[model samples]
Target: MTPKKEQMTMKQMMSRRAVVRVPSGPASIETIDVPVVEPGPGELRVKIGAAAINPVDLGVAGGLFHQLALVDQPDYTGLGWDFAGTVEATGPGVELPGGTRVAGFIDGFDRDHGSHAEHLLVPAANVAVVPDGLDLVEAATVPLNATAAAQLVDLLGAPPNDARRLLVTGAAGAVGAYVAALAKDRSWQVTGMARAADEQFVRGLGVDFTTDLGQAWDAVADAGALQEDAFRAVREGGRFIGMQPAARLPEERGIAVEVVFARPDGALLARLLARVATGELPARVHAVAPLDEVACAYQAMAQGSIRGRIVLVP
Candidate 1:
């Protein structure tokens, strides 16, 4: 009799992964079969349930990173950042039992594989247990953007008594909304700059909302990647935090320019996920697509104006 799938070992399995050989655009995406990898010490092999398609993924597929010379791969470049899954196998020093629901993201541009796969091997310390009620698709959207927002706020620090006014550009975006909401805890008089249509959503975060990029703010969080336009909105001697790490804007008018580059932190992600489950943080999904339809999904996202993430289910 033939062995069932559940009876097979990792070494006996082949997994499908999405990759970009040339990275011309979404049409260049292709899936290839590869041997399943076993988790090493302090690692866990997760059976991915969902992975979110972000702007970064689009950039990877569209050759943005390649143009910057940030990618170096002989075969193909893996495309994906965050995922939610169940622990299928554990390596030495991992206490999490098999079947534990978890969510996390890998940080970097150059890689042979990423979360957009049937199976992934990640450090146990880089993943957090997903809350009981949160769906894996929703959990997949939290790790990368939220971590980036939190880290951006860390650079913003506490607002000074004399300079408490802050403007967050792209307030309707994943990173901006989180920064708009979290910056309030640090005593910032927050304002959100978004489109007129996004007023309701931006205002719902308990911050002031405006469509205009007003000048003379204490700080400007350029989550929109407005670059020089957003930087110009900050007052003299104020702070300006940006999302683009590779293309940082120059400082002028004595404004402090800093950029956020998100890193993986399992313990911090646990707290963030708990907050997401409790409605303290926001999780939005634009649509869901099967792994086979990744090319279509990437094409849709590349058209721009997407409010929520498109999740890929394997």
Candidate 2:
């Protein structure tokens, strides 16, 4: 039988998941059977179509977050953050019916289950309907990165004056590209710092492109996780926002340092997904692999410098 048929034939009492018990690294990843949990009140059970592999998932699989004491699951740690799927069942007080296409993410590292599975139980308020134009594979890449960018820009706020020069490192990256596009609404003159080859893509977002990280910007959105390096580019008393919540940079030289911890906001995601559907935002997918090939996909992502996300289909 094909994987899809096999999935349908599996008993409804159990689900398949990618997990790590010791988290030694990608090599330690294991696919195992887990109980199929029913949704509680105000919750929904999603039959996952696609889940995106992210740096955070790598951290979970490699024991980085475990070393930091962020994960405390006794048996195993779940992998994956963002996913796009169809609602299979809804609990009491939920309005979405079965078979509705949706995309969303679950935040935090201390969990026994995640989106990289045959099924997921998520809060109804944490997901938004997948729009008409966007496919599940591409939609899976949006929730975590785009939400983080929106939250990071929220911390940056509006520039104090008209001379609002802002530098965004990793402009070609998932989060950085969203930041570059969204920051313009706050009246900031956004300059994306990326490789010379990324000039066209960065400029396509209606932001200036720079191959170098020049100094003395009014604010610096460090989506690249440059930490100290990106912090130094900010002018005195300027704002410095970072995506790394685990390794937050200390404030210095009158620069305000803040970090974004992406949280699920279904309503906010609806707006962002609409932009993607309209081509106002980009949905980048590097590759798609079956759920059984998760370990290989994680290995490929670990090699570094991948431009787009690798999505896993179940």
Candidate 3:
């Protein structure tokens, strides 16, 4: 005998969305009627609760990934990489029910859909269960920043001779702060670069010390400019990980300089979320705004020097 099919609830679907084009104009939130996106195989349709605004989002809106995307999708793209939401529908081969809370990111260059909307569709492998006692709002901020930090540390590899001294430029920023904390947890002696005002906060994250680029360069003659300054405190042969992608750092005096660009990884994100719930790592949030205020969120990020992430609640 054939089995009965499960009933799926359908609601009036209108998604206020943010769209970016190849010309790369600024992104603004606009309310418009949107078709309900049925999940394909290995996909889930989530009702987005919150999404975080990252600097890369702005980069995408400015057409940074346009060339990469055109090879796959030949049209205007959507933005928003990080989001937390409830599963509203499951596609073929998906096991999660219609109410499971989860968080994840869409590859900004994927060009399918993004998180800045009432509903989002993403791969099942790209999401992790939100841990108990963590707000979806805060969980929304983790996937991108934490993943970036993890990737940077991973690139640095295991410390040599069981003696680890690491330097993190932009340590007070979102990605850098997490890097410092995570490296500290791994028994690396961390020296963070941040302005004097943030010394207390940077040290609170378990960093052994904090200094600015000026202070780091004063002793090193700014070899290779600000990035190489990070090498001043790092033990010779130690690693210098930089958060700024555009900045160039020269390898000098046996110190290695590397730049990290965070990519989406659901499995690693799941582990990081578990750490947050257990108080092993902290998720810092600067502010929360409704999705309608997405422009303001972007503007705030552009102004610079916000300690944590700005989350947009849908």
Q: Give lDDT per model, in order.
A: 0.91, 0.92, 0.72
Off by over 4 Å in 3: 1-11, 22-32, 64-75, 110-112, 213-259
- Candidate 1, which segments miss by more than 4 Å at Cα? 1-12
Q: What lDDT tens digits, residue by residue, belong to model 3 across residues 48-156?
A: 9999988777777666556444324555466688999999999999998888999988764656467888898888988998988998988998888888888777776
Query: Which residue pairs of candidate 2 clash?
Result: none
Per-residue lDDT tens digits for candidate 2, residues 1-314, read 99887877676678899999999888999999988888999999999999999999999999998889899999999999999999999999999989999999999999999889999999999999999989899899999999999988888888878549999999999999999999998889999999988899999999999988899999999898888888888989888888765478888899888878899999999999999999999999999999999999999999988988999998
**In model 2, which runs have C-alpha deviations exceeding 4 angstroms?**
1-10
Ranking by TM-score: 1, 2, 3
True-structure lDDT of candidate 1 = 0.91
lDDT of 1 at 187: 92
Residues 184-279 of candidate 1 have per-residue lDDT tens digits of 888999999999999999999999999999899999999988888888888999998888653788888898988889999999899889999999
Reference-based TM-score of each model? 0.96, 0.96, 0.81
**Least lDDT summed over 10 consecutive residues: which range in candidate 3?**
216-225
On the 0 to 100 scale, the lDDT of residue 181 in model 2 is 98
Supply the TM-score for candidate 2: 0.96
